[model samples]
Target: MITARREAWTGRVLLVLLMAITILPFLSLFVTALHPSGTYPPGLSWPGEPQWGNFLKAFQAARMGELLKSSTLIVLGVVPIALVIATMAGFAIGHLRTAGRNVVFIAFVLGLTLPFEGIITPLYYQVRDMGLLNTRWAIILPLIGLFMPFSVFWMRAHFVNMPAELSESARIDGANTWQLFWRVHVPLAMPAISSLAILLFLWTWNQFLLAIVLVDDPLKRTMSGALGAFQGQWGTDIPLLCAGSLLILAPTLVIFVIFQRRFVTALLQGSLKG
Candidate 1:
């Protein structure tokens, strides 16, 4: 009885500690956002007034609608193309017995180690030569290229863990390479696909360096890019900055809430597959 009681107490204490660690920062941000514009002493009662309208002000000043549109376009372009390329590359590497499959896979893995800074200058000149710089495609294409190696590595692990008999059975059923992958393997890999899509969406949406380096126009900037601009414009307004950050965080939070299970499970499964 004593051990059980102690264990329960310990669990409760840990839970409370964890909750405080997670929630306190958000609570402080909320309080700061609610703080009145005027001066105040060291510490006292909550602000008598809350600038709840700061959210709308953030949206207007950041031009959040255009930011959101650019973010959506970049994510939409990157995720689907990255997934398709990743799936095909993973399938080939995992299943095919080609002469240089391992070498090719290693080459792809090497891409993961290449720093963005190393390639940015060359990429800038290439984008300029192609006349893609300052356009959404500049950001989208670079992000897809940057993120593809990781996706391929992830999907390859998932495909390798899947039973060989699955693809064999598909082949026995008169399914060709495309059909085997799309109808048989791809459907089974939906969890990994979903996990990758969610991650890719989050990364692309939060992309700032690409937007800053690739795009000079305000209308072409994403939420993160717009936030950078907003910070420059409202350099002294901390509440507005916090409100803008929270607003930018909303979509990814909503996505995680909606697909938390698949996102977590697929991430684990992809990494842990035999």
Candidate 2:
């Protein structure tokens, strides 16, 4: 009992330290953002008097309004359809005994190993050739495909563990495949679906590399992608830049805080089911 207690205490201390490490940069950024515009603080230090205007200045200068709209539109275009495709695919592979299931699952598993950076050159050329360059579709279309591997895997982990008896009973009621999926399985999959939605929203909203490489117009890019240009323009204005970054990070922080439980639940479910 004493040894176990010591181990538990050690784990608790490690967790606390890890949490602090994670939070430190954001704390530094928040503190730095409070400094006057154009001034760089030597380290993490609070200003004598806060320069609250820096946030407003950063917001307007960064064109956050436009970036926010573009990010929202891209996320909308990506998440729902991706979810639909991923969920259907997951259901087919996990619950249903479809032909070539192992081969298809292996294909998706291999897709997990593909690096996003490796495809950028070819992806850009393909997008340009297709006349999608500088458009949101350039980002949106590719992200849906890119996200599928992990998305389908996560959903499959859930559906695979569902009792086959559920499908058997549903079929006895004269339910077809479509009805079994739509009426029975989908409602029960809401926890997994909701958590996946939260994750995809965060990913699609914050996607920077694809957004930057594919789209040129800063206004059309994701808020994070636009930050590259914003930083280039305002790099000297450290406080303003930090403030703008914090602003860009706020929505995601709010979302994660709100849905953190669901996210944690998803992790737990995956572990238990797997």
Candidate 3:
């Protein structure tokens, strides 16, 4: 009983420390945001008159409504396609015994090593050539392509660990390959698939690099990209920036919080089952 109490105390301390570390930057941002817009203190004293309305100013100045709309559309567009493609590719790579499967898997693994910065120059030209430059698709396609490798590799690993006997049994019962995959394997692989979907959603939502490069039109930019523009407009408006930063961060945070339990469960179950 004494040992258990000590362990619990240790866990509580660790949790508090982690929470403090995670929240410190955000707290600092808030403290700055609450300060008077033009006369922020350098020494980090609490604001004399907390300007909570700076968030409104930041939102209006950044055209945050349009930015939010555009970002939502982009995330909505990319995530489903990425999930479907990754799921199919991962399943295929794992289940099929084709000669080039290892080669293909290796190619995907290599893709994880490729830097987006290195490919941006050529990718920009390619998008421009395809008439996708300046369009939302420019950002969407590139990000999907970039993230596919990691998604596929992870899904493949999960799928490969699933029992072959299940597929074999399905085949013995005369289930077609498609039927076996969709009806049997997919249901069994839900934990992995759910985990992947959550991850893909997070990645696509927070994507900034592709947004910066592919989207030149401010009206068509993402939340992250729009934040950059917001910074340009209200660089000195630290309070507003903080409020805006919190606003920008809120959606992803809510999403993670909502799905976090499922994410943890799915990942743990998938890994263990695999």
RMSD of each: 2.8, 0.9, 2.1
For model 3, residues 1-274, the per-residue Cα lDDT tens digits are 9999999999999999999999888778878877777765564578777787877877787777888899889888888898889888998898767678999999999999999889999999999999998899998889889989999987898888878888899899999988987899888778788888888877877777777788888778778877777778777766777888888888888989998998999878866765
State the lDDT of candidate 1 residue by residue for 197-264, as single tens digits. 88888888888887888899867877887777888887578777777788887898899899999988
Q: What residue pairs are clashing in model 2?
A: none
Ten residues in sequence with the least summed lDDT for candidate 1: 36-45
Clashes of 1: 0
Go through the candidates in order and give each one's C-alpha lDDT: 0.83, 0.94, 0.84
| Candidate 1, residue 238: how far the Cα is off, in Å | 1.3
Q: Supply the TM-score for candidate 2.
A: 0.98
Residue by residue across 73-185, what tens digits does model 2's lDDT show? 99999999999999999999999999999899999999999999999999999999999999999999999999999999988988999999999999999999999999999
Positional deviation of residue 152's Cα in model 2 after best superposition, in angstroms: 1.0
Worst 10 residues of 3 by lDDT: 36-45
Task: Flag clash pairs in model 3.
Answer: 33-239
Q: What ranges in model 3 sit over 4 Å off?
A: 1-12, 42-44
Per-model TM values vs. the true structure: 0.89, 0.98, 0.92
